[model samples]
Target: MSATRPPMTAVGADRLRDELEYLKRVKRPEIVAAVAEARAHGDLKENAEYHAAREMHGFNEGRINELEAALSNSEIIDTERLAVAPRIVFGAIVDLVDLDSEAEVTYQIVGDLEADIKKNLIAVSSPIARALIGKNEGDEFDFVAPNGTKTYEIKGVRYK
Candidate 1:
């Protein structure tokens, strides 16, 4: 059987591609040069510089592999091109309001790798995103978070 592809937003896929490119074109070469320079300094076992460079190289390679795998097994979805009215799905941007605080927030429901709370991009697996899923505009729902349960109102939903 073929490997199942994980869902990914177009933006998330592009970010991963950019990161993979940077690691391969910039970081990989920089680490290789550092390792070479360190190797020129004599003994291998006791050389701290050499060991550190090797460790960093390993990390860089690991990240490259990880990005490659993620990209390979990903099903990228472009929300902007979607003809249907955005109804809180993967790649849709949702606007929400906190019922208690009356504060407003916007979040883009994205893939696991693209989840960055700082950027207001939430993973589909996250509690808030799960709660928001399948919800229509102006819909109210209760979400049970780690802190406690909170009520949220769906102010709007946009595909783009």
Candidate 2:
């Protein structure tokens, strides 16, 4: 049996690709130059600059490999190309309201690598997103948060 690949938005995939390209085409060469310059300074045993450059090179290469594998393994979902639906799903931008505080908030369900809480991009596997999935607008659900259980109402759900 084949293992299911994780889902990722097209925007997230593009961002990872851009980072990979930058690391390969720009950071890699810059680190190479730094290593060469450090090597000219003299003995490798006591050269801090050489050690730092080598460490940076190793980290850059590792990240490039990680990004490549993630991009290849991910199932890119383009929200714009999908059929619009009221129910929440992967890559759906959802608008929600706090029942207790009456506070309004928005979040986009994304892949693990793309989830940024500061930007309100929630991962599909997150507690809130899992609760919101398959639910329609006007539906209410109770979420057990770190603070406490909070009741929320789905105000809207959009594909894009």
Candidate 3:
């Protein structure tokens, strides 16, 4: 059987690379030092420092492995290489207005791995983003949010 992995956008790849660099350059050494210092403290059975350090080491190593695997298998898509259009696609920045509340919000449509709600980056698979797909300016779409169904009007779509 073959394994399938999610495609990562360029921004997601960069974030992953930054995390990997931090793990390798900073976290790994810090964990190693902590483990060594804990080991020097003596009695492994009752050494609180040793146990804590060991736990931290395990977590750090696990994360390192996971990041490495993701990076290795990642399919990075450059946003600049994508064709620009009115309809939503990966890397499209869309401006939306809430039809009910008349509130305005902008979101960048991105890959799953790079989705950050705080930054107004929505994953392509998200309900709102999914509804926005294939829609152009002046179009309206309804999304089922946790509270209830809400409608949004597409104000604009841009590549940048």
Model 2 has a clash total of 0
lDDT of 3 by residue, 82-153 (tens): 776677777888999999999999998887767899999888888888788888888888889899999999
Per-residue lDDT of model 2, residues 1-160, tens digit only: 9999999999999999999999999999999999999999999999999999999999999999999999999999998886756888899999999999999999999999889999999999999999998999889999999999999999998887
lDDT of 1 by residue, 23-60 (tens): 99999999999999999999999999999999999999
Worst 10 residues of 1 by lDDT: 82-91
TM-score against truth, every candidate: 0.95, 0.96, 0.89
Clashes (backbone N, CA, C under 3 Å), per candidate, total 0, 0, 0
Indicate the residue-level lDDT of 108 in model 2: 96
Once model 3 is optimally superposed onto the true structure by TM-score, how far is the C-alpha of residue 108 displaced, in angstroms? 1.6
- The top-ranked prediction according to lDDT is 2
Model 2 misplaced regions, further than 4 Å: none
In candidate 2, where is summed lDDT lowest over 10 consecutive residues? 80-89
Which residue runs does candidate 1 get wrong by more than 4 Å? 1-3
**Relative to the unseen true structure, what is the Cα RMSD of model 1?**
1.3
Write down the lDDT of every candidate, Cα atoms only: 0.89, 0.94, 0.85
Name the lDDT of candidate 3.
0.85
lDDT agreement of model 1 with the native: 0.89
